[model samples]
Target: MVEPNFSSGRAAERPDAAVGSAPLAEPAAGAAIDPSKEPEGRKETKHLSRSRLIWRRYWRSAGGKIGLVGLAVILLLALIGPSLALWDYWVVDDNAFLSMPSGDHWFGTNQGGFDVFAMTVEGLRKSLVIGFAVAAIVEILAALIGASAAYFGKKVGMVLQWITDLLLVVPSFLIIAIISQHTAGSKSSTWLLIILLAAFSWMISARVIRAMTLSLVNLDYVTAAKFMSVPSLVVIVKHVIPNVASYLIIDFTLGVVGAIMSETTLSFFGFGVQKPETSLGTLLGDGMASATTSPWIFLFPAGVLVVLLLCVNFVGDALRDAIDPSSKSGGAA
Candidate 1:
């Protein structure tokens, strides 16, 4: 007991030394640390998702803002304007044939005695449907064929390339004109035109997608998926297409403009959306002769078409800038 009292006296003498000592010099190498148990003074960093980043960039663009707002207004007009119109698009107002804008005929009448207001809205609706439908079909076809070609190179890629080249050289406009003229007699000419437009339009987009896929096919995830025995279709769908989706989105927006222009051009030449069911093209064609005499007919539809195309172009440009890493057109993210 006396010896133990000496040891306790020595320990009591070093009490201040223990209190003065530094904490452990370092954590053991590779020691596990729970992030949740981190000190209160430390702060964790957060990251934005890819979609949010792209959206932020898009919203920052002046063109994107204008395009979004304009497109919404146009869509609203197309949907709700018909309900508020004084006269139906197809109804014959013999008494007010080609009349000027008035309380009764707000946007006036065409030679067919149809309301300009009603016809404009209806045409806008049809153009939107055709434009969107064609763009969707083109993108689907381009994605599948292009991704497949690139992933399964060799004979398949060569054949696809050949076909694409052939289509490029072929007179798509003339062929479309011929087919559309023949189909004009049918009630589904508008739908057929969409198919025709999609068929030719996809070749260019497909080639671009194929080029993109070639670059992506050998990437780490793609190679790993192959090593893991993933189905080729699944690999293409899950990996390749998503990588190229940004380009596809840009192409799709531009495709809408192309499709609309194609429809309008065909209709102008008397090969598109036939009688009974009108479109912006048909309105423009009808108004061209009386452009000076009845400026309202030509001016209203033309203005709408111009505005629609401008908005689409704006959105497309913004999307391209936002998605491209090298593009400085989109201001700081």
Candidate 2:
């Protein structure tokens, strides 16, 4: 330093020696930076699960909302209409036979003097019960058979496929009619009808489920689960079915309609829900005979039936569109 070292002089004269830290350019005037804000492209949003997303899309659709409302009204009627009736469904007023809609009998009386309003509500409840029962049983059977066949493949798959094919070709209506005719008056008739409907209904759905399961079976996650020593049943229950749940749900909805129609047809033909135990079908059958004479008998129940089916179809369509990402009809608003 005393000798005026050149390196020290150079360092002292350097710009870096004059400043304690590197300088950064100041932002332009009025261009403030906020740490709380993120770039639009990098902004994060909350994630929703598949079911919640589907539900959101479904409720947003006009048809879905209408359908849901209609169904709720129908269900409310089915549940409470009987209790509100002035007379019980079984109560017959000989003087009120075929009476027109009056304050005493809101929906009038049938030929047998049974309260049409009460009977109609009872029939709706029974029909709904049968439809739900058949649909649930069919779906369970289809899921089990279809998933098992796809997962096992080989001989097991072939046998199941053959059975399914055979059943598909069989005349389900005729077979059901015949079986139901024989079991008509039995104590277990309702259960028998449910089983028969489920038995025939499952074959078609099983085939569809099998195809879907086959596609899922070879997926990486499924394969990984298998490799990790997970049980086949567990993998199928946990992975396979969940992946195909959308299809199952739609199928179940349609199945309910189908089952209800089937029961109605059979009952109309005297092969289901035998006498004394009325269903919508039985009411319909009775109404047809005197339709022209007493239009109320046919009009009210038929109206309810039409409404039920329409609502169900609407709901099913909405569900299909909502659950399927490829669908454009029920896109989020």
Best candidate, TM-score-wise? 2
Q: What is the lDDT of residue 212 in candidate 1?
A: 84
lDDT of 1 by residue, 1-333 (tens): 445455444446566546445543456899998888789778576688888889988998999999989999999998898899988888989899889999999889988788999999999999999999999999999999999999997899999999988998999899998888777657788888888889998998999999989989989999999999999999999999999899999999999999999999888778888887789999999999999999999999999999999999999999999998789987776
Write the residue-wise lDDT of candidate 2 on 173-261 in tens digits: 89888888887677888998999889899998898999888988999999999999999989989999988888999999999999999
* Candidate 1 CA-lDDT value: 0.90
- lDDT (C-alpha, whole model) for all candidates: 0.90, 0.89
Off by over 4 Å in 1: 1-45
Clashes of each: 0, 0
lDDT, residue 330, model 1 = 78
After superposing candidate 2 on the true structure, give the runs of residues whose Cα lies further than 4 Å from its correct spot. Answer: 1-43
